[model samples]
Target: MISTKRVFTSSPFMMLICGSLILALALGFRQSFGIFLKPMSLDLGYSRETFAFALALQNLVWGITQPFTGWLADKYGASKALLIGALAYMLGLFFMAKSTTPLGLMLSAGVLIGIGLGGSSFAVVFGALGRAFDPSKRSLVLGIAGAGASFGMFAMLPYGQFLLNSMGWFGALIVLSITCILMFPLSLGLKEKKIPLKEKRDTRAALTEAFHHRDFWLLGLGFSVCGFQVVFILTHFAAFIQDHNLPLTIAANALAIIGFSNMLGSCLAGYLGGKYPKPYLLSLIFFLRAIVITIFIFCPISQTSVYIFSAAIGLIWLGTVPLTNGVLASVFGVQYLSTLSGIVFVMHQMGSFTGGWLGGMLFDRTGSYQIIWITAIFLSILAALCYLPIQEKPLNVLKATMQPIDKA
Candidate 1:
């Protein structure tokens, strides 16, 4: 087991509360960006692709920077990483408000915000929590933290819409920019010491071991599907609703319902993961996603249907995050949890980039979101299959002689 006690001085409950709030603010604000798509595009005279591509680049940059930021969190302190992230995120939002061109949006919204997200979001927060708690409590805590992100989604979506209506997108982004400054103090709550592991494997060795493990790749691949589905929805769902001529309120409410439902789902998934096989739970979540997407697409498009779809989708939304990160911590140990989790997140964001960009590209071409929806269903089924073969056995780092790594 990893040296959990030497790292954190605070109570587990306190850590969870602080960590969850950070997640809530970081992810909640990020999720609300979709609400800006229509207004920003119209006011700026940019195409949907321009808007979508910037968000897509944001995911890409977020993924690219995650490993480095995660390494910083793992080796130095989460607080430092979070400090840098919050500053970048604040500036990103501030500049994004002033952006009048595609290039400006890409630089601020895409590059800067992505860097901010890498450090301040799940990887660093959960790594601190993972190091603080033992295996038994880890998943549940992560689940609870995941719920904070859900709550952020629930709370921020409406807030974004309200701000957009009252203050306009530019002013709304400025306010949101100011909101990120709160993370600076919140980052201090996650401060941890760099306690050495009992079994002394360095970062390179840990990464090499994981790279050689078939299960890690499988987990990353499976997680990519999640990125694809959620980012597409977050970046384009409002536009999708608008295309069908539904009022924006329906879209906002639908998103809120999704976020609210996921709060319960994340907690339930976390609870179940502790008792049951996490891989199996993950498999089930993906299968359910495929089924839900199918049902939603085949059903008539109405406010009631949208709400139902949002609720159903939200319940399973982001449940994958806790379980997936839990698997990495379970199998590899928490010493390098942030670094490893960050690598897997890169895969997730690759899918996110594709989903966000492709949704817009296809829509602009065909004037429908049908293709992307179908693609999401197929990817979900594929992701479900990817998890079935994963073996969640903990690595035996303390063995007298190293066993051959699983490369299959």
Candidate 2:
């Protein structure tokens, strides 16, 4: 027989650890997609815009579907949803290897992988983890998982390079496809914990409350800038480094530095979120990002400078993720955490689509990335301002002013 008491003691933390490993598997491989830019575009006979557009589509599709994915995770079960997502992710990677045309690439890499990411990435797992822990510990749990996700970025770049060098890109994708199946085992651990929505409001009532909240939109807008800045840099920065006559190894190492630093940042942000206001932490992160980007661009391009910039930016990279979701959970509660957080993340995706597409389009047109870099600075400052006015309070604060709904 199963001991219910034993399950309570170890399971939540175990689920958090398992969720972290799963996120590393999903996001680590996804992060390395940037490394494929030069090789894939050249080999496929496609322009940078074509490749960029496909990735942009991927971000858009992920954003559009995330709410539904979150709803599924909440209503059915996150582990089941994750299992399905892992299969789609593996299938997407497998077909991406065989794709010869823009259409096939877009469908496989953009649509299928996007759906896979919507279910398997931090969005789904964080929701599951949020429910597993107490509200006070939510940020800490998220940070641990966020650090694990960041570690994927830390570990995957060099691994991807090794595979690229030895097995070739197609072979690398095939291997990665097989790697996606590992999520099934990890998913098993998450099934032990469940967040019953009956104790909280229904999905529609939560959605209705969130959509009416001013802070929700403000947070979403700020998150949009977060997506824009990071994805643009991730997608194009290495190529930009090469354009400066630096070594490819420098670019790769710089990326590794960013990832390595982010693990610490994710954890720090989580700790800070528990004590301080998450919106404030978000503002500080964006403000720092703007400063980092401005300095990196105007200064001389050298290997040391690249590493410094990478490390500085990396420290703040995914720090916002835990804090952002932390803020949402703090104010609204975790019952519909997945759905609400996913809705907010949609803004981030829209920004991702814009940032990736704009960088490539402007590069093809102007033969430079200066304009987009400047635009990022402007957006960062704007985002910092957007988070300043968010009122971090419970959704229950509105309960007195509104009608009660049947949670059952």
Clashes of each: 0, 0
Global fold similarity of model 2 (TM-score): 0.94
Strongest candidate by TM-score = 1
Per-residue accuracy of model 2 over 243-339 as CA lDDT, tens digit each: 8999767887788888889999999999999999888889999999999999999999898899999999999999999999998888888767888
Instruction: Give Cα distance to truth, residue 71, candidate 2, Å.
Output: 0.4
* Runs of candidate 2 exceeding 4 Å displacement: 1-10, 192-200, 398-408
The alpha-carbon RMSD values of the candidates against the true structure, listed in the order shown, are 2.5, 4.1
Candidate 1 CA-lDDT value: 0.90
